[model samples]
Every structure is written in C-alpha cells, then in structure tokens.
Target: MANLQLAVKGEYFDAMIRGEKTEEYRLCNDYWNKRLVNRKYDCLIITKGYPKRDDFSRRIDVPYNGYEIKTITHPHFGDKPVKVFAIKVKLTRSNYVAR
Candidate 1:
C-alpha cells in the first residue's frame, strides 16, 4: 500500500510529533472524500508546511491505525456540528522512517 500525504503546521504538527495527538481530521467534503473514500493507506506522511522532500525532521511518518466518519462540533466547523473523517494515527520513535 501507499502513504497518504498530509500538509500540516503549527500546533497540530507539533502535537503529533510530541505524541500528544493521535488523530487527524478532514472535513467531509468533495475534495477529502475523493482522496480518502475507498482508499487504503499504509501510513500517514505528515509534513510541516511545504518542507523539502528530504527534510525528515520536519516530517512525520506515522502508522495509519484506521479512520471513520463521525459527526462532531469543532472550532473549525463553527457552532453547527458536521461530519468529518477522523484519521487515526500512532506516533512513536520508530515511526519516523528515515530514508
């Protein structure tokens, strides 16, 4: 299987790197649905912003535990709850696959 590449930055990225965050959320829209629906990913290639391809320190290769569609209320979604794809990930010392 291949990897799902995600561009993230700031707090979210740092949280994942520090093992404080274990999941990522994607809005349930056409764009995300097309990329995530019916697709099987081996892992999540999380990058901080648009870093160089060789910048592993700014990238995190974490395990793709699973994913599910759930309705939830979040700051990004305002007051109304919306559906989102919750992508489960597991970060660890060995997860950063050095090339």
Candidate 2:
C-alpha cells in the first residue's frame, strides 16, 4: 500500500472527520497524478497545515485523520480539459487535534 500525505483546509478537514466528505480532489499536476493513479489501495494522512517551501513537505507532523482509498477518477480539469486525480476514500482513523 502507498502512504500519501495530503493537506486540506480546516473546513474540509472537519467535514472529513465528521464523515460528511467521502472524496477529495487534487489539482491536476504531474507528480500528484502519477502518485495517485493505478493504485489498488493507498493510505492517506490528512492534515490541516501549510506545506513547506519545497511544496511537498508539511510543517505539521501529526495528522488530522487517516483514510483508505476506495476508488479514483481522472477527470478533465476544465475548459482546457486537462487531467486531474480524484479519490474516493473511507475514513479509517481519526487523529484530529484542535490547534
């Protein structure tokens, strides 16, 4: 299984924790698309924090929640119709710590 790290806004993070959101969408990017596609299962650690300057690292070490990937969709971005990755997930654990 692949271990993936994600950063989400506070509101969306709350929804995921509350079991209101079952899917997450990521902006279409080469790195993200490659990592998320063709995976049977992925372990996702969702957090509410800003990523570091490098754009991949997060400032926070603790995760807000964790999930397992159930399905994935690669859809066109918009008018330009670029591809983007969307994942359907199921909450497996909650590690939310109010900050």
Candidate 3:
C-alpha cells in the first residue's frame, strides 16, 4: 500500500481572505491508514485543540487518483507565511496490474 500525501496550507488565512468563516477543523493524519482497498475512501478531519472528530468533507474532497491539492492564502510573492499540512491516502490502481 502506498501513501498519498495531501496538504492544505493557509487554510485559516484563506477563510479570512475570502471573507468566509474559518473551518473549525484540521486533517486527521493520525487515524489515516493506507491498507484500505475500497474505491470509496474517507478522510476524517481531526480537529486540533478539540477532543472531537469533524468531517469537513465539503471543503476537502478529492477523488481516488486526484493530483496533489494545495491551499494557499495569497497569490503574489512575499506574502504571509504558507503553512503546509500533509495527509497520506492509498492509490487504487497499480502499474503492474494485469491487463
């Protein structure tokens, strides 16, 4: 099993920049496992500073073979520091799969 690392940087700032409320959640990188082989995968957002699990499925949605998705607050150079977070998921297809 391979791990697909996904990250969301400046998530807090993006909410402020777009004039939207900050998502009171964080990626659940701990409970994530790459052993699951199901087509339908789930990513549980493990909220920091809180003892609860919240699923921000609407905000952080990606398909099985999705490219790396990064979130930043600003577009130009020399802006706010970009905070990077990473998550690992499993890949469905294998190159050595029999044709």
Q: Which scores better on TM-score, 1 or 3?
A: 1
Q: What lDDT tens digits, residue by residue, belong to model 1 across residues 1-99?
A: 989998876688889877788778899999999989888888888888988877777788776776889998989779999999998878766766544
- Order of the predicted models by lDDT, top scorer first: 1, 2, 3
- Superposition-based RMSD of candidate 2 using all C-alpha atoms, in angstroms: 6.9
Candidate 3 C-alpha error for residue 35, in Å: 13
> 1 or 2, which is superior by lDDT?
1
TM for every model, in the order presented, reads: 0.85, 0.52, 0.20
Q: Which candidate is the best by lDDT?
A: 1
2 or 3, greater by TM-score? 2
lDDT of 3 by residue, 1-99 (tens): 333323344554244234453232222233332322232444422221222235242133223342232354545323664432323322223311111
Give the clashing pairs for model 2.
Answer: none
Please give the RMSD to the true structure for each candidate, in Å. 2.1, 6.9, 12.8
lDDT of 3 at 83: 34
Greater-TM-score candidate between 1 and 2: 1
Backbone clash tally for model 1? Answer: 0
TM-score of 3: 0.20
